[model samples]
Target: MNVADKNLARVGSDELAANSPDTRTRHGKLVSPVITLAHGGGGKAMRDLIDDVFIEAFSNPTLNTLEDQARFQLSDLARYGDRLAMTTDSYVIDPIFFPGGDIGKLAICGTVNDLAVGGATPLYLTCAMIIEEGMQVSTLRQIVKSMADTAKAAGVFIVTGDTKVVGRSSCDKIFINTAGIGVIHQDFKLGADKAQDGDHILVNGYLGDHGAAILNARGDMHLTSPIESDCAPLHELIQTLLTAAPNTRFIRDATRGGIASVLNEIAAASKCAIEIHETKTPIRQEVKGFCEILGLDPLYLANEGKLVAVVPANESQAALSAMRDHPLGKYSADIGSVLPGGRAGRVHMQTSFGGKRIVDMLVGEQLPRIC
Candidate 1:
């Protein structure tokens, strides 16, 4: 028997759903208005939800086979690189749907970027969903479609996945977890400890847009602005930058604690001092205004599509130029550099007012559940 047949074997639809007539059709699509516990009961109802939702959205030869695990040819993996890279992330952002992206997009971007920052080209992903029983099927379908579209755009595939339904109060609505695998070229190497003194620091584009957008989306402050989450895949941009500056020392997605946190981590790891110029930092004025009003510092805000790169001083120009040419990095800038002669893990910022201040680790979260 084929894998798809095996996945639905041992029980005919009539035998599996003797008590739940009319809940599904021949292809195992749910006709119910909303999700129910039976959808996760490992029977015809469960198969119906999978066929109607996940299998339909992420249809591919490997996934359509409905096997429990995704298989790959060893030669295909070796064709890309000498080493394998893998990363996993879960998305539990409070508001599932947001201005620039939803939970689905955030999950894909987060996992993909985690691999990209380490110089990996993402290939395959596994998705797992925990859906609330009372949630609308339409909402679930929408999120799945978003994930499939984003994966395709990023040049990756969702090859395997699992689904579950829980009590209405157990899960907020839906939460998604994604695990990705990628390959790193034989010659590629990257690490925070690899940062060298005199290396120039660069950022792809504006910071704090994702943080500001999420905060505004929650409606806690009751304010409005034109900010949207900067959630996006970074592998392509990273590849372009590497081609221009092959000696790049390190790259990190400025996610939860923002660039301030990334710099501190880099300094501590490399045992070097670093400094940044506020005048050169790229931040949207609206985000700055949002931070000012909330008594927050834009430096510590989260970012989904931003990264901190350390490139040798000689190649910084090439790196900046390459990033600027990419669709996602038109505002790329050289924000700072690793300072010389003080290797005590210190990071400082030169404010626009010509005053110097220490840039330290974020003590507490400025925002919670922000991917």
Candidate 2:
């Protein structure tokens, strides 16, 4: 078997024993072995499916009530911070299961990172799923379990959800949508328009691993490598950076379109020019080779666990130190700087070959359905 297949096989073997057929019962009802149209018909089959798969895996007081909506106490939210931050994201990645993570884990981390980059402490999330009829019950159970573990690690709760089943052709095997709510401290203020001249640009670690891993997992190119998705929660890393450099001008997660698109957006919003040094940008050798072979630019490839920070020149060292000290930011680097307003709304890169080039927004989709 190829590397991607081998990796998936290993994951299945490791988890299948615990998730066998004998373990598929809840409330004295044996859950259906496979999803059918009846599971989405809003009747006993639907309730039983929800109870056995979702509610069972994500058990908490708020979610257990089985109410139409989840309610939160304002007083409890006020303890974390004064401002609230909320974000929602959908995951429709091909090959629902991939190296290092699956669609379920991606949904949680993507939403959590969105709130984190906005200077918020993520508190809760809502999960909604659209499943294709005929998908295996065992597959749904595995994905839901992965979501539960990721939510617990991020210190957030999944308190509400909705499930819909459609004809097999209407959707892929499954799709996940997650919305997150967080609280931000009154002292923290950040936005893309806040970037200023002389602000140093920093990235937490290597980029494009998630995109590369997903592409390889599809096996379209018949290629293989040890690259795994860099899918992870960045709230702690952001919190640490904020503590060390309170004057950080802006922070953004490098997701779709990678760091290139993020820099272009920041430049346009702030009316400033961003200049990055090619030599300083960190990229895995395997990803670089893969991109080279495919005629792809790593800069435009997506990343899940990376963030770009714009901090004042004076505080750059402190921010770098704080990032490097964290487990996720050990490979952090100051890749570039926000320059004066002469070339407003532009992103330029200093190529390693001693030349400069404009890094503009992508003209079209480089990879579609890549989450």
Q: What residue pairs clash in candidate 2, if any at all?
A: none
lDDT of 2 by residue, 1-371 (tens): 12342244234322322222232234724367899999989988998888888988987767776678777667666755688899999999998998989999999999999998998877779999999999999999999999999988887788889999999799999999999988787778999999999999999999999889999999988886898999999988888898789899899999889999999999999999999999999999999999999999999999999999999999999999999999999999999998875599999999999999999998888899888
Question: What's the residue-level lDDT of 191 in candidate 1?
Answer: 94
How does each model score on lDDT? 0.86, 0.87
Give candidate 2's whole-model lDDT: 0.87
Q: What is the TM-score of each candidate against the true structure?
A: 0.92, 0.92
User: Candidate 2: lDDT of 313?
Assistant: 95
Each candidate's number of clashing pairs is: 0, 0
